[model samples]
Target: MIKRLICAAVFSGTIATNVNAEELRFTVWTGSKAHLDMLNDIANGFKQTHPDVTVRYDTIPFGDYVQKLTLQMAGGNPPDLGWLLENSAPAFVEAGALADVSKTLHATENYNYADFSTSAMGLWTKDDSVYGIPFSTSPFLVYYNKSLYDAAGLETPDQRATDGTWTWEQLKKDAATLRNADAGVWGYETVDGQGYSARVWHNLIPIIRAYGGNAWTDGTCHLDSPEAVKAIKLFHNMIYVDGSAVPPGEQGDFFSGKSALTVTQISRVSKLADANFDWGIAPLPAGPAGNAATVGQAAVVAFAQGKNKEIAAEFLAYMTSAKNVAKMAEFFPPARKSVLEGDAFLSSNPAITPAQMKIVAQGIENGSVLPSHEHFPQIEAKARPEFDALWSKDADIQATMTKLCQGIQPLL
Candidate 1:
């Protein structure tokens, strides 16, 4: 009986030791094997200091990330660390759902917090509290099929960009020429072909900005502004009138050689590793407002409800250090000023030419991030049906813009 009691004590001690060595749960939207491998490598580095802590990265779909994360928070199972999109930053911060990680960042040795650009850190900070660190500051660019341009007997977008002739009006004409229904070739495709619905704002913001408009400013909706309306009309004409761009319910993928052009970030060049056709990237065409580069940003945040909030903050600091930021720049553009302007960033991706990378580097330096609001998810929910109404022919451009503004105004 005495020996049994001693065994019981040993077992209890083992259980307690195991409980002390915790595994941190992290959530990310990417399911790609390559991406996960890189992330796991970074997580492995934590062992240098935290020998017993393990991090598990859970993959959440981009469209449902915020919704599902909120559910986890409600269930008291929130991840220790997660990737937050810019639009959700304000809502998350305002809800007190994210831990204030400024102290951890400030205390980290050799972290170099000031290396992050002032503009890049704007949305993640509120006065004295810092909630997150921006990981991706990717700017939108036009990826064009060089073969299609050659077949269409027209100069490529990069050529036009250099000649100062790459305007939205010129794109409309070029797209019309490149489109061939008989050949099953489309002139343009929006981000992943979900633009009209799941990615409505992502699809239109670049053109809207190029035309000198924004979703809102100072608590007012601007979708109905003259510039915004004009920009939407041009895209409408491409889908319905010119029949160049792939419209709602249709599919045309540029990487598959079925589409001539697409507007996304440089990271997507990974999709062209085995391309059968030639491709090149160029800055988004200029509009009446001149060159208006647009960026989409995501950040690393530690949840306020995490079981190990302090440890999560320490890991966040390590992952966003200049060294790790440069490592991640191969897939996700870094927001660090030192990395963004360095030669390492220029040659980070083997798939892209140095000149093409220059376009990306320039856009990061001179672009505006997509519009973000505290109530963005609510605004998107309300604006859904209104935006759907614009996909049809004979859709009154001015009237639709007014209705869209009306739908999202209350949420604004």
Candidate 2:
């Protein structure tokens, strides 16, 4: 009888262990084969440590990611883990749709909240509490075609890094010198639209900060200042007055080898690598504020509505780990110190060396994130028309910004 009881207890324990080892489902909105392969490798590694646990990965097209994710959440079934951009987190968080991982995230010894870029962490924090682990983050960088600079007899921006001489004024002057109309190449081309508008914002904010204009104060809009007006005027000048940039409508032509320089995110490096021109990346131009800052975007967050909260959190933790993060960093730069300093990340990408990565790291540390206000989308919608008008020289800068801010104020 005693032997039978012991055997029964052991059998039940084994069954419980098997039950605990079930597969977890994960969903991501955007990634490449290399990204998915790295995720699979991380899952395999996780399985090795916890033999009973399995991970299932799913991907959604970037175009329909939000709509599909919303439908899935409404359908009473959601993945164990998923991706969330920082600017888009408030709506879901306000709806009480994300699992609170404050306790789990804080309790982990390897997790250092301070190690993440402030912009990345700000997206997940609400009322002084953190809700997500940032997986990927990037700051805007100024990429120049080295060959163009050499041909123009213009000095490289990188050479000015130590002296802090690479200011916006200098960039504008250099761009003018490099412009070649006969060859159909302009000094620069950057879009001002829904997503690409970020590039404009990234370039503008530093100027605003330099001019001592603040975007917000204690969650309130403070963009209606003289300094802000000056910054906007500078942008208008870039597009219409100085003609440094291709006109808004003809901007696409620039990407087709018609622009001598472009200021965009580091991610564009991969695409530009295949371009017929020789190019190199550099930090953004300095502003009057005595500092250069870039806007960091695209942070990963876990949804509150996920079915397998615990398992999803575990997967998120694994995804942010040094090894896995380093792999992901090959595509999207890592947001943590461990991965940033790890050999895997430091040695993986030959295109961006550790030194170049350090410049990006510094940018994130000193930069800011787009605010997560409920009215942000509304503000963006209203501002677009005004910005377009200003860029086209159809309206005065001050009047346009004033009207733009007024239109967005009611929504806020």
Candidate 3:
């Protein structure tokens, strides 16, 4: 009888342990095989110490990321952890949607929370609460097709950058010269071909900043400023007058060899791993105000409503440690100072040469994160129609910008 009781107690304890086992769901926007493989490798490492834990990654398309994430939360099915863009950080933190991982980070051995720069942590940290940890403080770069440049007997963006002659005006000239209509190739493509719609800010902010203008400041709108208008006109000319940029209703993809140049972050490097043409990355072209490097940032956050918040935060801490951050530097440039300055980071990816990686490092050192506001979603909604009017071949730059400012000023 006593032997039977002991066996029953042991079985009960085993069931209790099984009940405590966790499966964390993580959401990301990337569907790249390389990216998912790297992430899965990292997730597998967590199982070393957390033997009973498993992590599942869910890939949501970039265009639907924010809206779908919100819907998931509203439906009480939020993932335990997810990636959040800089633009979404402010609103998420304000809404208490993200879990505060400060304690977990501080408690983790050798987590080195201080390794992340104050500037890099600005959007993720609010006072003493850290809603998320920035894993990618990536800077905008111009990726050019070296094969096309060679065929055309033109100096590449990399060469021009080295010669200190790579300016916005020069890029426009190169784009026009490289345009190959018969080959179904465009001179340039905006970020992911959604630049005119979902990514309009990503499409225009760098140009505006390079021209010595900003979206807003101190509760004011600057899109209607003289500098901003001049910058917008240059891009408008590239689309309509120069007929260089892949405009709205077009389907040119830089990775598919349909465009000569594209403006995007280094994370897109994964898309070129098996490409047929030679490609290289360069700093954003200099403009009237000189090279105004802009960064697009994203962070890993634990949802406050997660069923297993504590374990999710632990994984977040582990995923962002110096060692893991260095591993991720292959695609998502690190926000951690230790990893950013390490020699290993420069050679993290076999696809990127150390020389090309230097351009990424330089941009991160000099760039500012893309503009973000707590009212960003609302502001974006208000500015959409106004920006839509600017896509026409005969659009009036000054007038459209004025309307955009008028529409978004209240939100600002």
Q: Give the winner by lDDT.
A: 3
- Please, what are the lDDT tens digits per residue for candidate 1 over residues 27-62? 998887768888899999887889878899999987
Worst 10 residues of 1 by lDDT: 10-19
Residue 363 Cα positional deviation in candidate 3, in Å, after optimal superposition:
0.6
> 176-222 in candidate 2: lDDT tens per residue?
78777777788876632222343445556656776667666665555
Span of 10 residues, lowest total lDDT, candidate 2? 11-20
- Considering summed lDDT, which 10 consecutive residues are worst modelled in model 3? 10-19
Ranking by TM-score: 3, 1, 2
Considering only N, C-alpha and C atoms within 3 Å, which residue pairs clash in candidate 3? Answer: none
CA RMSD of all predictions: 8.2, 9.8, 8.7
TM for every model, in the order presented, reads 0.92, 0.79, 0.94
Off by over 4 Å in 3: 1-21
1-412 per-residue lDDT for model 3 (tens digits): 2122222332332211212338898999999999999999999999999988999999999987887877666655668899999998887776777789999999999998889889899999988999999989999999999999999999999889989999988999999999999999999899888889988899889999999999999999999999999988998999999999999998989998999999998889989977899999999998899889999999999988777888999999999999899989999999998888889988998999999899999999999898888877778878888899999988888998999899889877
Sorting all predicted structures by lDDT, with the top scorer first, yields 3, 1, 2
Per TM-score, the best of the predicted structures is 3
